[model samples]
Target: MAYVVFVGGLVVVLAGLTWFASWAKRRGRGSGVAGALAAYEEAYRTTAHQSHHELRQQADRKSESGSPDDL
Candidate 1:
């Protein structure tokens, strides 16, 4: 039936993606799809959220400038 064919195609696509992800992982951290994903995540996090280190550095800079308005 048409439904069965559609489901089969979906399954095949999912399986291929799973395989590719595993392959990328095995290729290591600094290369291939895994590296690209890591770079993207780091960029997004840096822009979207402030880490503790970043917050501390910002606070230090404000204190150095002795500007209460910065707070």
Candidate 2:
């Protein structure tokens, strides 16, 4: 009984995924599996890891530079 319940839930989840894929195709982002994966990667990159350490270090160095500004 438990196995049957799990299989039923899996089927429902798969069906929903298929429906979404079909919709995505209509929107032109689901042409190929590779293309869909690429789009997802691009979207992820826009909000993913960023390297700001170099800029921070430059700012810190500018502030710490010895000049007339230093006592």
Candidate 3:
């Protein structure tokens, strides 16, 4: 009997948490779980960062070349 009550209480707590998460998401606020996961990936993952300087250099070269028909 005690075990059954414990399990029921656990289920109610979990359901309440699920409802709160859905409400928060609808309000345009996250639980910060995504940001935490992103930070973890950035810390451990390679190729996660972009080279802005390299991108700018490529854009400059393309502009200088005008068009392919110029060649």
TM-score of each: 0.45, 0.41, 0.53
**How close to the true structure is residue 55 of candidate 3, measured as C-alpha lDDT?**
52
Q: Write the per-residue lDDT of candidate 2 for residues 3-45, one digit (tens) a residue.
A: 9999999999999999998898788774477545556755686
Question: Candidate 3: where is the Cα deviation over 4 Å?
Answer: 44-71
User: Model 1: how far is 71 from its true place, Å?
Assistant: 51
On lDDT, the leading prediction is 3
| Pairwise TM-score winner, candidates 1 and 2 | 1
Taking all chains together, the TM-score of candidate 1 against the true structure is: 0.45
Clashes of each: 0, 0, 0
Per-residue lDDT of 1-71 in model 3, one digit per residue for the tens?
99999999999999999999899889967737756655665677634423433454586784445677887
Q: Candidate 3, residue 45: CA error in Å?
A: 5.6
Best by TM-score: 3
Candidates ranked by TM-score:
3, 1, 2
Model 2 clashing residue pairs (backbone): none
Residue by residue across 1-71, what tens digits does model 1's lDDT show? 99999999999999998998788678754355444655675777665234534654686784446569878
lDDT of predicted model 2: 0.67
lDDT of every model, 2 decimals: 0.68, 0.67, 0.70
